[model samples]
Target chain A: MKIRIFVTLKNGVLDPQGKAIHHALESLDFKGVNDVRAGKLIELDVDDGTSDSDIEKMCEKLLANTVIENFEIERPTDQAAREA
Target chain B: MKIRIFVTLKNGVLDPQGKAIHHALESLDFKGVNDVRAGKLIELDVDDGTSDSDIEKMCEKLLANTVIENFEIERPTDQAAREA
Candidate 1:
């Protein structure tokens, strides 16, 4: 099975990169775009029996830097429908 | 108040950028590193009482390009505790 981890900056913290992109978007005439934030994704291919706790551990230990970021995990079938 | 959104690619898809970074990590002697995926994060500064559904709408409507990606929303208080 495969597990996907998404990591992102926590709220209330300033995101310099997001601000830069927001500015760039505005300069490019993309209006109504208020702000931006940035994050990372990690994909893990594992045996079919990886537990949810294990996946969470991966997010906690490696996939994300918890001090300023948050992460979420999704299974393939669940993610495919949720995003769309 | 603020809302933070995280967008990530779905599993089973190839992440060329992540692969490149993985190779770089290996070259740098970071062992046990397997694969990486890339994604985006968005931070929105809004009224203190923005509804959960409204934030969900933002993710569904624009912040996340759902076709190949998935997104999650976390309130400041929740995210701060969850990630840590």
Candidate 2:
């Protein structure tokens, strides 16, 4: 099975990389871009038996820094349905 | 309005960061982790009038590297319903 994990900075956290991108956008003449925040997307291919809770445990143990980041998991099959 | 851009490496492209993460997970004893790939998620706050085509233009100009990356855009309100 394929799983996707999105790790994003928590509210109020300072994101220097995001700031840099925002600046880059402004310099590129892209107007009306009020703010920008950047995060990580980690895709994993695991055994079919991998349960949802196991994935959550993986996030808590290593995938995310809970102190300053939050994570959301998605299955590609489910995501495709939503996209359609 | 809020927009999300997911940038991922194209297939066949080498991803050292992803390799490192996979190694880390193995060392941590997380079984069934077959493969891992890492990418970026960029969130933007823009004016409500910002058109979808304009956002696509942003991706082409600076948000994503067309040479080895692909980007997908999503609006928060639309995503919320899908999640529910």
Q: What DockQ, on C-alphas, does every prediction get?
A: 0.21, 0.76
Over 4 Å off, model 2? none
Write down the worst ten-residue block by lDDT for model 2 chain B: B75-84
lDDT to native, each model: 0.66, 0.92
lDDT of 2 by residue, A1-84 (tens): 888899999999999999999999999899999999999999999999898998998899999999999999988766875576
- Residues A1-84 of candidate 1 have per-residue lDDT tens digits of 656676778888787877875675556544354566666656666556667776676667656779988887867665555444
Question: Measured by TM-score, how close is model 1 to the native structure?
Answer: 0.55
User: Fraction of true inter-chain Cα contacts (below 8 Å) kept per model?
Assistant: 0.32, 0.76
- B1-84 per-residue lDDT for model 1 (tens digits): 666676777777677877875675556554454566666656676566667876676667556778888887866775555444
In candidate 1, how many Å is residue B40 off? 4.0
Best by lDDT: 2
lDDT of 2 by residue, B1-84 (tens): 989899999999999999999999999888999999999999999999999999999999999999999999988765775586
